[model samples]
Target chain A: MIFDTTAIAAMDKLQRVQFATTLPGPKPLCLVGTRSLAGRSNLAPFSSVTHLGSNPILIGMVTRPDTVERHTLRNILETQSWTLNHVTEEFVAQAHQCSARYPEETSEFEATGLTEHHHPSITAPFVLESPIRFALKLEEIIDITSNNTKLVVGRVCFVEIPDESYSPDGTVDISRSLASTALDTYFSIQEVSRLPYAKPAPPTP
Target chain B: MIFDTTAIAAMDKLQRVQFATTLPGPKPLCLVGTRSLAGRSNLAPFSSVTHLGSNPILIGMVTRPDTVERHTLRNILETQSWTLNHVTEEFVAQAHQCSARYPEETSEFEATGLTEHHHPSITAPFVLESPIRFALKLEEIIDITSNNTKLVVGRVCFVEIPDESYSPDGTVDISRSLASTALDTYFSIQEVSRLPYAKPAPPTP
Candidate 1:
């Protein structure tokens, strides 16, 4: 059933959301992440993080569009960098608490109980608590027009995952970490199906 | 945790990829939508379609760069109009199949056996199969990067949803539609948790 952009458009206000709100969702365990400016540590949970591309490795987040000058957007703009850590169900609660919207001047690292680590290649800090994390360079801050939303795109520069998560061929098994999702009125993840890669075209003949 | 630009910038790619790949497995659903071009029908699937804003109502999609000149992108560019339709779990199979790369001259409506409709407000065709859809006008297109991705942003000119999908408080209950996430290699969506709109602050009786 093909839907047109208009009919698709008519589907209610599902998109233009600020900081995509989720419920008691499935959070990664040990939501270990860090935040900072210049070179300080500010550990935090980034539940709003999302993926935008795979080729060059891009990630995104809908930030609090600042009519004012100070915020995550400003920090990204000023520093031109950021990082995301994958927390397993082991620490999602801690990750949620990371949503503490700390004052701009404070560091989440000192604020949250999570530990911090430094990336070897990039200057960013990462959540030592998180088994996995990645550094990213701010690519753009799209001034989204809907309600007051800003789409922030980042280029993933580095990544860190526990050795067990991905197989040699890049097959990731998230069963180890408690992951999550965003629904209209809730945040949950219920298994629907398991589809393998379209069976490799049945041996091509 | 407040992760900083420098701190966030140093994490690794594998770590970052796992964090950004939100849904663990197969959410075999695509909102089938249509658009009419020069009185013809066009059908396409966009897992990348996520609302970027909501005030004036903006919709955006992170399209796969383009092979042979981006059909939907070109259509929207030419007509300055397009639509979005909600695809349910029922039609996800057909929706995923529509993503087959057809040449610029090919119409997906024919390849995937979809119906098409046109709106009076915009010249682009839309999917008649969709129970709900919306027409839109292009607002902006930002190049997220040089690799192979483009964010197509548009203004919601019109919208349509089933009566059941909407809540009383001006929100769209879009959970009924299927979702897809890039796992190590598959796509899946689960019913994670209910959305939790924050309740009012407690009164200081």
Candidate 2:
């Protein structure tokens, strides 16, 4: 069915948000880990992460308006460092719980019973159970004036993944990572095929 | 295995790009459609399309430096409109072929044998074969000075989807759509389960 802006505008706020978020299809899910100046750790689930560039190895994630105290945003800004831990089926429930609102002092790791693993090179801690994780240093914080959202760009300073998951061509086989999608749906993607770099068909004789 | 920034820097440029792009896991693949001022249609495959905000229904895609003539970016900037058609398994090969270098006057739809459908409200054309598509108006163009990339933010003004594919709560069932992922790889995702909103477990009695 076709939905024009008028039809979309007619939708209630919740419906609009749900439609907009889910229509983008499945996104890469991760647990963003950060630490406050006082050493308090914060963990939150985000699906907005996307590759911004490769040369400098940058990744960007959008954070909603800071109408309320946003612990993740605040921590990242204060510490200038954060970690992204890929969510897998083994701890999907625990990862989901990270979204729940908690007091500023309450750490999701403690609340969700997830272990925190500290890397020597970065100040932020990562989820020990997560098979794939990356430590990033804050590069830029773009205030998307269009809405109050903030686009946080981070430089990947460190990465940890199982050796077997890394393909020779540099593609990480996340099929075993058990990536989830949407608000509550979990999925296991099956590889169809990887074709060679596309080229125009040779002219017919 | 763990890889530090120094290690990443040591790798060749090609390996770095491949590792950085794939390490983020699968992305939402789409054939971005646009029309030049002269009315020539252009289609290009992009996996960087990401959800930025829901209020204005904004989506962002990264465009490599316009050092060379980028038809899709040029068209969108000139007309201030574009369409994003989700790439499905059936047309994966054709969609990939759109990435081939085509002159500014050439239409990928004609060259790749894909049909273009025009909508009355939008200047750009949508893929006739795509079950899911979106018409967007240019909202903002963010320049990433760190690496000459452009993040084009578009406000979703119109959307078209098969009636059956949309769920009541706003989730679009992409499984049936056969959405593919990675650089050249395709995948059919299987929904494992949908859990309820996460809340702290009730305190033990």
| Top model number, lDDT | 2
Query: For candidate 1, lDDT tens digit of each residue in B37-141?
Result: 654456666545554444556656666554422667777777677777766556555555566656555577666666666666666666666655666688887
Tens-digit lDDT track for model 1 on A1-205? 2234444445445443421221111222223233346655445443345557554567666555542213555567667776666654445455554556555565656555666677565656777766556677878776654456677777766656666765543444544343443422223344455444321122235
lDDT of 2 by residue, A1-205 (tens): 8888888888888778778877676677789999999999989988778888887899988898652228999999899999988888788889888887777878999999999999877899899998889999999988776777877899999999999987666677677554455667777777877888776667679
lDDT of every model, 2 decimals = 0.52, 0.81
| Model 2, span B44-162: residue lDDT tens | 98877788777789998888855222888999999999998887778888887887877676788988999989988799999999888999999998876666777899999999998
Among these predictions, the greatest TM-score belongs to: 2
Proportion of native contacts kept per candidate: 0.12, 0.68
Fnat, model 1, is 0.12
RMSD of each: 6.9, 1.9
Stretches off by above 4 angstroms in model 2 are: A67-69, B66-69, B178-182
